[model samples]
Target: MARMPSAERRRQLTEAAIRAMTRDGVPRTTTRSIAAEAGVSLSVFHYCFDSKQELLESVMTTITEHYVAVVRDAIRPRATVRETIRAGLQAYWDHVAAHPGEHMLTYELTQYALRQPGFGHLARRQYELYAEIYEALIEQLAAGMELDPSVKVPVLARYLAAMTDGLTLNFLVAGDAGAAADILDVIADHVADLFRADT
Candidate 1:
């Protein structure tokens, strides 16, 4: 193909890798397959990613960004904190519902990384990334709403991350959109209660 910036090329390859991995399990996806999926030469794939581990990291980060961006935009201050929180959670739930395969792929990636020798760090980093994103989102919501969280930001962030993680998996397994929506309402109410006026 015509020349493109390295960053752009990497993004193209990363998206292709996600498609390949999401379609074929992480264990089955190979760099060569990703190259083909990206419609790029093997050399180009190698030029973009040094190792499969690096590619996996990029894929994980990209996948998280996909949904986090939606939630970020959905979380703009609303009539009430509960509304804002519910909007964000609902945005995330919508993403999970629409892309259940992709969400399932994330869990598969975590398991694949953990079971692979010397790759455990990838799984840990995957989780740490989740908490980090939640922390940033929490801070954003607090600042936007001028609210103070009863729990520390980091603690609250991790709790939210864990709650969503479990809830997403539950939805995937149970395939119950109505039940998931009800749970999101509960989570939004619970999280909103954890905040108060900043003053």
Candidate 2:
């Protein structure tokens, strides 16, 4: 019989895996490296995840869920919609500044997903998750919006999410998060105006 993992052990392993993959990208991320990074043996990796594919999938899912939750929690419902949006975007900036390479794993995953059908599903799931966050923010702030009825809220949300992701990526590439931060407020304000015009 296999020994069950304690909660702490499980979390430590998962987090170690996250750090390793994020830092080294998927091609270089091996079970052995992950095990060493986590201060465990190959057997421990096998016990926690059935295969490398399974572990990769779980790591991506974990990263996606954690980032999504951070975006969701960026705003308080009680705050003004504009404030909520700013808070959320700011949280993202902070996250990126702290974990630059981490998102590179996501970018790499995005590229992989774009080509492979299996990973493509993960990419689609991530887009939908982002759209969901955007929708929530718009729905909270946008009432009687004036854009084309068919695409109004969703369109706004898509643009905002897309722009936010783009800016994050650009900052990472340029190594100038401060430069990006300077423009974020203006962009958010513009987004607010774009959607709130009809409200």
| Candidate maximizing TM-score | 1
The CA lDDT at 1 in model 1 is 75
**Ten-residue stretch with the least lDDT total in model 1:** 143-152
Q: Candidate 1: lDDT of 159?
A: 90
Instruction: Give the C-alpha miss distance for residue 187 in model 1, angstroms.
Output: 0.6
TM-score of each: 0.96, 0.75
> For candidate 2, lDDT tens digit of each residue in 141-169?
55544444556777778888788889888
- For residues 1-199, what per-residue lDDT tens digits would candidate 1 score against the true structure? 7999999999999999999989998888898999999999999999999988899899999999999999999989888889989999999998998899899999999999999998899999999999999999998888745545356889888999999999999988989889888989999999898877655
TM-score of candidate 2 on Cα atoms, chains taken together: 0.75
Question: Once superposed on the true structure, which residue ranges of model 1 sit more than 4 Å away at CA?
Answer: 144-150
- Residue pairs clashing, model 1: none
* Model 2 ranges with Cα > 4 A deviation: 1-11, 77-79, 115-118, 137-151, 194-199
Q: Lowest-lDDT window of 10 residues in candidate 2?
A: 141-150
